[model samples]
Target: MQMRVSDEDRERTAQQLQHAFSEGRLNQLELEDRLEIALTAKTYGDLLGLVTDLPAEHAPPVPEVVELDSKNGNIKRSGDWSVPRRMRVTSKYGSVELDLSEAVIAHSVVEIELALDYGSAKIILPEGASVNVDAFRSDWGRTATSEVPGRPRPGHLSVVVSGKTKYGGLTVRYPRKRWFTH
Candidate 1:
């Protein structure tokens, strides 16, 4: 028996077709044809046929754990860096800044473990990303999020922050929007 396809299935197929086109795997005409058929697909088989000739989508391999440490200086990561699945950041009397607005995030969820003393950690997330700090413990310090939610958003990245801080601060926020481009 042929299984029926849902709207989500059709949209996913369409996105795959678009990705193939952008990757130079499909020509403009081919993409259009596949997209039209994908949009009108009535069964899973129909949608599957559209992308059968293309290479399978594969996510980049993420390291199990990445460690970032500092003792007396600031640590900063920004501009198109690859995000690991799990990260451990340690600092003492030094601030840590992670800017993920233009990062290459492969996973749907990211875990960050922090250890700090007399320093602050600032995380800047991309749009539509959510962060949770429920597992974080700060003694003589505070954890704050600005204009971002603690729960995960649908079809968006979710960040889980955990660890301990002593006389330090943790802040998570989205990038600032610019109204004008020079």
Candidate 2:
């Protein structure tokens, strides 16, 4: 019996091909060819063949969950950090700031579970990235995501921000543009 692949499967394969190209494992022509096939592949086997030859290291293992816990201090993450598939953040009386503009994100969807009390969270996403806060709940707090859309964009990262906040607010926005560059 043959199994059919979903659009997500095809997109994942294409991302893998792009990663391989960035790592120098595949040349421009090879990347283009594999991407074309990956986008059109209708079966798992067809997609698997595109990345089977690449080194295993090229595909980093995604952790099940990464926890960022803070008690009295701020939790700040920025500058080329490797983003996990799922994250749980627990903070009390401290602010949480995650700047993912230059982060390495491999997964299509990133889940962020926030448990904040008397603190705020600010998530800075990269260009083309979208965020969803449908599952997020706050008590006496506010959420400001007016600068970004709530739906995910094709071929881009989608962040799902969930969990509860008390006496604190949540802010999701893109990085600020630098006016001058040297």
Candidate 3:
């Protein structure tokens, strides 16, 4: 059976090439060539050549799960951490914060399931991350999201947030970049 390639697959391959370039693994010309091939790839096999010589992405030691109970303390995860395919965040009288600026997201789309009860949750994403609040239900609570004002790029990561909040607040904030910086 032939495997079809998705846009996300192409995007991820390109992103891997970009990372290799940033890490000095590939020269400018080689990086450009690989990126072109990745973006134009039509099947999974086509992307294999670009990452054949590179190191593989490693998964976290444990199942990627972040949980916060009724501890009443602040919970934070940031800086080069592996983002799991599914993230479950539950806060009872506590605050939860997730920073994805420097995170290593292995997937094109991440699912965040939040359960807040009399607490607050905040997600801080990078300047170009795409976020969608598919479903949000709050009882006497509030939810607000501020995203990067542009259509999602092909090689960008997107986040999907869902779940419920009762007497709690959920906020998603993205970085505001300067004109000089991309």
Every candidate's lDDT: 0.82, 0.83, 0.72
lDDT score at residue 69, model 2, on the 0-100 scale: 87
In model 1, which residue pairs have backbone atoms overlapping below 3 Å?
A: none
Number of the candidate with higher lDDT, 1 or 3: 1
How far does residue 71 in candidate 3 sit from its true spot (Å)? 3.6
Query: What lDDT would candidate 1 get against the real structure?
Result: 0.82
| Candidate 1 C-alpha lDDT tens digits along 73-171 | 998989966688999999998998999999988889999999999888899999999999888878898765456798899899999999888988888
lDDT of 2 at 40: 92
Clash totals for all models, in order? 0, 0, 0
Off by over 4 Å in 2: 1-62
Taking all chains together, each candidate's TM-score versus the true structure is 0.65, 0.66, 0.59
What would the per-residue lDDT of candidate 2 be over residues 1-182, giving only the tens digit for each residue?
02467787788778888888888889999999988998998866577677768975534234457788889999998995678899999999899999989997889999999999999899999999999988888898886444778888999999999998898888898889889878
Q: Write the per-residue lDDT of candidate 3 for residues 1-182, one digit (tens) a residue.
A: 02356787788778878888889989999988888888888765577657868877511022344444445677677786667677887777788788888887778877888888777778888766778775766777876455543345678888888888888777787754558855
Q: How far off is model 2, as Cα RMSD?
A: 11.1
